[model samples]
Target: MSDVTTPKRGRPGYDQAAILEIAVLAFNEYGYDATSMGVLASRLTLSKAAIYHHFSSKEELLQLALDHALGGLEGLLLEPGAATGAAIDRLAHVLRGAVHVLADRLPYVTLLLRVRGNTDVERQALTRRRAFDRAVATLVTAARDEGSLRADIDPAVVTRLLFGMVNSIAEWYRPTGPTDAAHLANDVLAVALNGLRTPA
Candidate 1:
C-alpha cells in the first residue's frame, strides 16, 4: 500500500451553510456580478454540480448572504433593549447592536451595503435595509420627542447620520486587530451620542 491515503468520496461533503459562508466571502472578494457558480465551485474546490446541489443558482447564494446580514439586523429590533427602554437608551442599544452585527457579519454586511438594486434579490435587500433605517428613524423621532437628542436636527437626518457612521465601519474594520466588536460599539456610541464641539 502507498504511504499516501487516498481520499474516498462520491460527492464532496458540502452543506448549504458552509457554501453560503464561502459564497459571501467570494462575493465580497469579487463583485457579485463577477462571481459566478463556476467561480464559486473553483473557490470551494468543488464541481459545478456539487455547488448546484446546494444552491439552485448564483442568485440564491446572493439572496442567502443578504438574508444573513439582514436577519441579524432585523433581530436587533426584537431584542429587549431595543424593544423596551427610554428612547435614547433604546437608540443607544440599537446602535451598539448594529455595530456588533456589522463586526460579527462583516463580509455579509459589506456585501449587503454594496447592493444597488440591479436584480430582484438586490432590490429586496435594499428594501429591507430601508425598512431597518426607518425603524431607526422611528427611534430617533422618539428620542427627539423625549428631548434626549439635539432639537436642531431632524430625526430623519439624525437617523441617516447615526447609521451612516455605524455602517461605514464595514469598509475598514478588521477582526484580527486589537479592537473588538464591543470596543467598536462603544466608540460608535460615544461619537454619535456625544458631539465633538466643546462648550464655548
Candidate 2:
C-alpha cells in the first residue's frame, strides 16, 4: 500500500491596486493619521507582513491614494475642451468632469478633501491641490473677462465657491444613491452656471 500526501494551499494575496482601494476606504473612514498598517491588515483580513509586502509604509499608501485623486483632477485641466472652447464652456466642462471624478472616486476624493497638511505627504498633496485651484481660478478669470460670468465677484472667490459646491459632494454622495453622476453634474452646472453666468 502507498500513502499519498495533499499539498496545503497558500493564502490569497492582494495586488497593489486592490490593497490601495481598501486602504483608501479605511483612510476615509478612520482618517489617514489614525489608520495604522495593523488596522489596514485587519480590514483586509491579511497579516501586516502581507500588506508590507506591497507597500513600504503607511505614508506610501497615503501618497498613492492622494495621487489617484489629484491625478484625476489635474488631468481634467489638460483636456482639449479645457483649452479650446470659450472660457465659460471650458469651465463648465472642467466642473462637470470634476463632478464625475468625485462620484467615480468618491472614497479617494473624500480622503483627499480631508487632508490638512499634517505631514510632508499631506503638504505635497496640498501644494498640488493649490495648483489645480489656481488653474481653475485662471479659467474663471477668462470667463469673466469674456463676459460669460459675472464680474462683480473676484475670480478667486468664484473659484473657491465653485469648488466649494463641487467638493461638498465628498461629504454625502453615494454611488448607489438616487442621483447618478451625469444628473449630479447637470444639477451642479445648472445651479452653478445659472447663478454665475451674466444675465442676457
Candidate 3:
C-alpha cells in the first residue's frame, strides 16, 4: 500500500517546464497583469484545463519564474569566487555571474526586473531582490574599506550604479549578438572598475 500516487502527465511535449517557459515568455512580451490563464492557454494551443493541470494559477507560474531568476542571483553569492576572495574580486565575480544568468535565462530575468509587486508572489520576489542588492552593497563597502574602490562615492550609490549598468544589459544584449557574455562582462568591468577619465 503506497500512499504516493504517481504524478499525472499533461499533454505530450508540454511538461510543466515547457509550459513555464512559454508562460514566462508571454509574461515578458505582454504585461504580467494582462496575461491570464486564458491568454497562456491560447498561446500554448492547449485548453485552460491542460494549463491548470500544470499550474494552479498565473501567479504560480509567475512565482516560479521569479524564483528561477532570483535563484540564479542568490546562488552567485554563495560561489567560491564570491565568498572566499577579496571583496572587489568577489563583486566582479557576482556581476559576471549575473550577466551569464541573464544570457542563459533572459526572459525569466527580464520578468524579474519588471516586477511591480502587484501580487504576493511579486512582493516576495522583490524582497529577495532587495536582499541581493544589499549583499552587493555590503561587498562594495568591504572593497572600499580595503582601499580597492573609490571611497568618495557612497557604497550604496556604487552598488546602484554598478547594478544599473549590469541591469541595462537586459535591454540590449542578444545571445546572437556579437558580444558574448564573457566579453561583455569584461567590457562592463573595464568601464565600471576603471573609468572613462584617463589617468593624469
Candidate 4:
C-alpha cells in the first residue's frame, strides 16, 4: 500500500539508527511478539521488503535495542572513575551511572524491562541482565571482604536486594518527574546499603 520501493540495503533515506528508534517504540507499544515486519513497514512508510533489507527480522531489531540499552550500562563500570574508588564508593558511583544510563536509554530499557521471557530473544536478554547484576554483586563481595560492609547476609543477597530496589525505578521514574536520576540513585543506594540490618 506504500509507494516506497526497497533501495539497495534499503537506504530509504532512513539508516539503521532511525529504524532502531522507530522499532523500539513499536516494540514498546506492541510487545515484540505482537509486532511484525508489516507493522514496522506501515509505520515507517516503507515497504516490508525495505524493512527486511535493513533488519534480518523482528528479533534482530530487538537484539539491536538490547545492545544499545545494555552496552551503555556496561561501559560505566570500566571507566577510570569506577576503577580507583573503594568498593562501596565504586558501588555508589556505578549506581549513579546506572540511573543516568537508565534515563538515557529509557524507552529501550523500558521495553527491556517489560519482556516476559516468551521467546529465545527475550530469554537471552534476561541472561544478559543477570550477568550485569552479577558484576555489581562482585562489588558487594569486595566490600564485604574488605570489612566495609556489615557481615551477616551473603553478598549475593545484598546485591539481589539492592537491584530489587533499583530496578523498580523504571516503573515509577519519569524523565520530567519532580526529581532527577542522579539524586534518585543516591537515595536508592543509601536505602539499600545503609538501611540494611547490621549486627551493630
Q: Give the number of the best model, judged by lDDT.
A: 2
* True-structure RMSD, every candidate: 7.7, 9.2, 5.3, 6.6
> In candidate 2, what are the lDDT values of residues 19-70, reduced to their tens digit?
8888888888887878999899999899999898988999998888888888
Each prediction's TM-score versus the true structure: 0.90, 0.90, 0.91, 0.82
Clashing pairs in 2: none
lDDT score, candidate 4: 0.79
Model 3 lDDT at residue 22: 86
Tens digits of per-residue lDDT, candidate 4, 111-149, equal 878877887878887887888898899988898888888
Q: Quick one: ranking by lDDT, best first?
A: 2, 3, 1, 4
Candidate 2 local Cα displacement, residue 167, angstroms: 0.6
Name the TM-score of candidate 3.
0.91
Tens-digit lDDT string for candidate 1 (1-200): 01111123354665677778788888888898899888998998999998888778999888888888898889899999999979999999999999998998788889999999999989999999999999999999999889998889888988898888998998889999888999989888878886555645
Total backbone collisions, model 3: 0
**How accurate locally is residue 142 in candidate 3, as Cα lDDT from 0 to 100?**
96
Error of 1 at 142 (Å): 0.4
Local error of candidate 2 at residue 23 (angstroms): 0.9
Better of 1 and 2 by lDDT: 2
TM-score-superior candidate, 2 or 4 = 2
Q: Tens digit of lDDT per residue, candidate 3, span 117-180?
A: 8889899899999999999999999999999998798999888988998889999888899999
